[model samples]
Target: MNWDKRYKQNDKPWDKGAATPVLCELLNIAPQYFHPNTTALVLGCGLGHDVAILHAAGMVTTGLDISETALQMAREAYPDLGETWLMDDLFNMNSNETHYDLIWEHTCYCAIPPKKRQDYVNSVFSLLKPGAYFIGVFFTDTGQPPQVGPPFSTTRDQVFHNFAKKFQLVWEGKPSQCYPGRENREWVMIWRKP
Candidate 1:
């Protein structure tokens, strides 16, 4: 998919204007996992809402996206966060720049083609500091045919199969709050790289 062109055309149906409530709830319920020195990488951080949330929580947060337009929009919207926006492909991040204490996944996982799902898991595993966390709100069911997606639907087994190799499950459950249509479709998970 031409993400830059999509951003250029303002065709982002997935660009919710704010951070996922799931992240907020996670912070509220598990504050011990986040701290001022924590370095967080938010994948596909379109418009920067979740990045802002993580920053506000006192982590050194970086919002990374493949679309320059999306990063530009993020920077414009959060001008004080000048250094927080990064333009890079998730799969091709600079080797020396890959370490992070936390990686926050929201729309990025489901937005990628299904065939790349395992690579996504491996890439995330390779980017974290030992025992660092991988926290995300995944779209388990998009209510569309399973085969048709950019926002692909997935199952708990698939999640386990992809992440079990390198991550230890910390916590996971459906969030109490969600964006309008996401109700039971969203799954919030926290994993630690051990």
Candidate 2:
């Protein structure tokens, strides 16, 4: 598969090897939103690290990725974490039409081609239950879009234009957590379904 080749070559520089610290902070800040019964979906959950975090938080979690190789690696790395990890196309996967309480997004938005961004937003909105949460860490572009893709850069305004119509902007700011050089390179965004 296209994505599987990257893992076969061990080329996933984007894998940080752990859940984003901002996700932990979100849980701490809004403990009420995450509970044992709460269902959370992690989109493009490459190595299932964030899925493990959600599992530890006592929420029913699922890790979905389009890459089977990534899913295999994640299952091996986090075998003890009880999570439902699946290989599915994000644009096609549905939560059995049940929707989720929270959608955890990290690096997924920036990875998609700009042309498909609208599709991404529509997919997320459709998969969330009314009044649910969509917490994400979006990669921001310092300037114009790059010539190559897969890690396309974006801005806050682009994000707002994409999902703000369907989801309410709850929080938007630079994240306190970063992995070394990524201090101000990404935007921590939270949106709620109205």
Candidate 3:
């Protein structure tokens, strides 16, 4: 795949160049969404936007991606924002020493193939401590044609169907801030791992 090349060539359109308001608000205003004791794991954390936001808010954050190129760029760009950065696929990751309190799902969900979404959900459950939180921001409706991907489309029902059994639905809504074109098309979700 051209996943690594996308960053090497600077061809990433999915990066809004900053953390979403859902993340920022949780850190800055909505303390109800997360606890200070929580450690965060940010999946597909290309370039550390949300990583920085979480770290700055005093949460221990780890940024993981499948691309070494992307991880290098993230470390180089924002060394102070992330507590740890790893190059690993979410599906294959395991940490015997640590279980996170909050898992941040940003671009990773939509980037993977639709059929593997359950794998993503399972990974999240395995990595989190019980009763922890999963904060997901999904692109509910994509205006792009079916052939266009990297950002695949999914609905609220799909998300609920995948996560509801293992995770208790805490809150679901729209993000307070999104990229320039993603205003109404996004779904901001919070679920607690049961």
Which candidate leads in lDDT?
A: 1
Model 3 lDDT vs. the true structure?
A: 0.83
lDDT of 1 at 179: 84
Question: Which ranges in model 2 have alpha carbons more than 4 Å from their true place?
Answer: 142-144
lDDT on C-alpha atoms for all candidate structures = 0.88, 0.85, 0.83
lDDT score at residue 67, model 1, on the 0-100 scale: 95
Cα TM-score per model? 0.96, 0.93, 0.92
Model 2, 55-105: lDDT tens digits are 899998999899988998998999896448878889886555759999999
Task: Put down candidate 3 lDDT per residue, 20-135, tens digits, no spaces.
Answer: 76687766666765566569999999888888888777778889888888888888888655448978888887654579989998878989988899999999999999988899
Worst 10 residues of 1 by lDDT: 89-98
lDDT of 2 at 137: 89
Q: Candidate order by TM-score, highest to lowest? A: 1, 2, 3
RMSD of each: 1.1, 1.9, 1.8
Backbone clash numbers for all candidates listed: 0, 0, 0
Give every collision pair in model 1. none
Which tens-of-lDDT digit does each residue in 34-100 have in candidate 1? 7787899999999999999899999999998999999998989999876898888888764745599
Better of 1 and 2 by lDDT: 1
